[model samples]
Target: MDDVTRFLAEQQYVELTTFRRSGAGVPTPVWVAPDGDDLLVVTVDGTGKTKRLAHTDRVELRPCSVRGEVAPEAPRYAGRARVERDAASVARVKRAIGAKYGWWYRALTVVEPVLERLPGRRPRAAVVITDVVPLDS
Candidate 1:
């Protein structure tokens, strides 16, 4: 595994910073798991992070609090992110997340089917972060 991927995979929460069209970075806390050398993040299909990705793949990532707060000393990494909406990819990410997060994730999985019945619930997509490297300090 790449150092960046291994490091972030061990973290409980990750602050995924996606870039706006204007180049501003929007950071969101997300559950992530390691998929080989890449980092996998699952999110709603139409979320801002996914929308932003349509315009740019450039992103920064850092270990952070569950609420998205990055500590002063956290290491940051830069990478290319791609949102995958295919069933296989989505399923793979969900499995990875469920394995890492355990019971809480299992509970979510149980509830997910019911939630999907909602009138307009967005489908989940998997965001794969690749080519990651530590940002220069």
Candidate 2:
């Protein structure tokens, strides 16, 4: 694995900053799984981050605490984000998340279908990030 991929794969959380059409950044701490040279983040459909991605692919990422706190010296990277909505790809990402996160993610997968039936409870999808490049912190 490359330095960036190795570093990222070791992280439990990453602050994913997705850009809005108005040029504002909305950062959220997310579970990330390395897929070859790329990264995948699974999130609920119709979220602000996913919605922003439909407008543009611009994104930034950095290691962060589970609560979304970024360390002062955390390295940052820029990349393009794509929302993957197809069933096969989303299923693959869910498996990746379950492998990395174990019980919590796996449990959610079991209940997700039922939960998604609730009002405003959307289905999950994967956000694939590519062309990652290190940026000055």
Candidate 3:
């Protein structure tokens, strides 16, 4: 988690690719924040991603070019992810976001609740972690 934590803290955005039920894949643009040793994202339940995450706890998060552009051939970094339910953990994640992105965090605080109440918005917390199994190099 150390390397991941550092990578995420420095990267502003990541392309989150999740598995779809139809044996396909879904790629989404997400604004991520650090959550201790994991990356945190707040999304509503019952969405396509929510369901997919429920079925499989794996996802790929790739750090894009700092210029805010990505090529079609970018290779994503892979990891396993899961839903986090603890209140303390949630608060920690929120604080991390606030610390990293100041003004944006303040702005989100105002709209977060409204977004949470939107239809199909479940406000679930996701934590992506690297697999412990070593890769052959």
Top candidate, metric lDDT: 1
Question: What C-alpha lDDT does candidate 3 achieve relative to the native structure?
Answer: 0.65
Provide C-alpha RMSD values for all models, in order. Answer: 0.9, 1.5, 3.7
The CA lDDT at 59 in model 1 is: 93
Please list the residue runs of candidate 2 whose C-alpha ends up more than 4 Å from where it truly belongs after superposition. Answer: none
Tens-digit lDDT track of model 1 for 7-120:
999999999999999899999998989989989999999999999999999999999998998889889899999999999999999989988999988976798898999999
**Number of the candidate with higher lDDT, 2 or 3:** 2
- Compared to the true structure, candidate 3 yields what TM-score? 0.72
What TM-score does candidate 2 reach? 0.92
The reply for model 1, stretches above 4 Å from the true place, is none
Winner of 1 and 3 under lDDT = 1
Report the poorest 10 consecutive residues by lDDT, candidate 1.
104-113
In terms of TM-score, which candidate is strongest? Answer: 1
Better-scoring candidate (TM-score), 2 or 3: 2
C-alpha TM-scores of all predictions: 0.96, 0.92, 0.72
Over 1-137, each residue of candidate 2 has an lDDT whose tens digit, in order, gives 57887788789999999997889899999999887887888888899998999999999999999999999989999999899999998988887778889998777678667887898777888899888889984
Of candidate 2, the 10-residue stretch with the lowest lDDT total is 104-113
Give the clashing residue pairs of candidate 1, or none: none
